[model samples]
Target: METLLQWFDLIGIVVFAFTGVLAAGHKQMDLFGAVVLACVTATGGGTTRDMILNVPVFWLAESYYLWIAAATGVISFYLIRYLQVPMRLLMIADAAGLAVFVVIGTQKVLALGHTPAIAMVMGVMTGTFGGLIRDILCGDIPLLLRREIYATAALSGAATLVILNDLDVLPGEAVVAIAVLVTLGIRLAALRWNLSAPIARMRSH
Candidate 1:
C-alpha cells in the first residue's frame, strides 16, 4: 500500500509539473519561472495538506520530490513548444494529477487515523488546490472558481474511496484504482463534452 502510494505520488508530481510548465509557457515565462511554477503546482496541495494535518511536509523530508518536479519542469519547458495543442496536453495532465492525488490523499488521511469526513475533504483539497495555486500564479481565473466540473470530480472520487473503505467493499488497491478511474472519467468527460455546473444568475430589480 505504501509503495503504491509513493508511486502514485511520483506520477502526480510529474503530471502536475507538466501542467505548471505549460501554464508558464502560455504566460511567456522564462525557464526559471517555469521551474518555480512547476514545483509549486506539483507540491502545493500536499504541502498544504501536511500543514493542515500537522505533519512534516513530504517534499522537505524527501528531496527527490523537488528533483522530480524540477526535472519535469525543465523537460516540459522545452517540449511543450513542439506540441500543436498544448492546452489539450495541459488539461489531460491536470486530470491525471487530480485523479492520483485524490486517492493518495484519502489513503494518507485514513492512515493518519483521521475521520472519513476529514479524509474526503483533504482528498478533494489535495486533488484541486494545486491547480488552484497554479492558476493563481499564472494570473488566470482558478478552475475551482469556474463552472467547470473540476473540484466536483475530485469530490466524487474522494467520496467513493471513503465509502468503499468504510464498507470494506474491496481491497485497498482496488479501491484506489476505482477512485482514480472515477475522477479521471468525470474530468475527461467534462472536457470532452464541455460539461459544466450550472451558474446562477440574478435578475435586476
Candidate 2:
C-alpha cells in the first residue's frame, strides 16, 4: 500500500505539472515562469498537506518531485507547440490529478492513525489546492470557485475510501482504485453534462 501510494504521488505530480504547463501556455509565460509555476502547481497541495501534518515537505525531502515538474514543463512546452491538443485536455488532467492526490492524502492520514474525518478533509485539500493555486497564478477564477462539482468529487472519493476501508469490504488496493474511479467518474460526468452547484440568492434584509 505504501509503495502504491508513493507511485500515485509521483503520478499526481506529473499530471498537475502538466496542467500548470497548459495554464502557462494559455497565459503566454516564458520558460522560467512556466517551470516555476509548474513546480508550484505540482507540489503546492502536497507541501501544504505535509506541513499541516507536520511531516517533511515532499519536494524538499526527495528532489524527484521538483525534477519531474521541471522535466514535464520543458517537454510540454514543445509538445503544446507541435500537438493540436484540444481545449478540454486541461480539464481531464485536472480531474485525474485531483483523484490521485485525494487518495494519496486520505490514505496518508489514515496510515498515520488519524480520524476518518480529518483524513477526508486532508484529501479534499490535497486534491483541490494545487489547482486553486494554479488558477490564481494564471489570473483566472479558480475551479473550486466555479459551479462545477470539483471539491465535491474529491470529497466523494475520500468518503468512499473511508467507508469501504472501515467496512473492511475490500483490500486496500481495491479501495484506492474505487476511490479514484469514483472521483474521476463524477468529474467527467459533471463536465459532460455541464453539472454545477446551484447558487442561491441572498435573502432580503
Q: TM-score of each candidate?
A: 0.97, 0.96
- Root-mean-square deviation of every model: 1.0, 1.3
- Candidate 1 lDDT tens digits, 87-123: 7888988999999999899889999999999999999
86, model 2: CA deviation in Å? 2.3
Q: How many backbone clashes can be found in candidate 1?
A: 0
Q: Write the per-residue lDDT of candidate 2 for residues 80-120, one digit (tens) a residue.
A: 87786676999999999999999888988898899999999
Give me the overall lDDT of model 2.
Answer: 0.91
Candidate 2 collision pairs: none
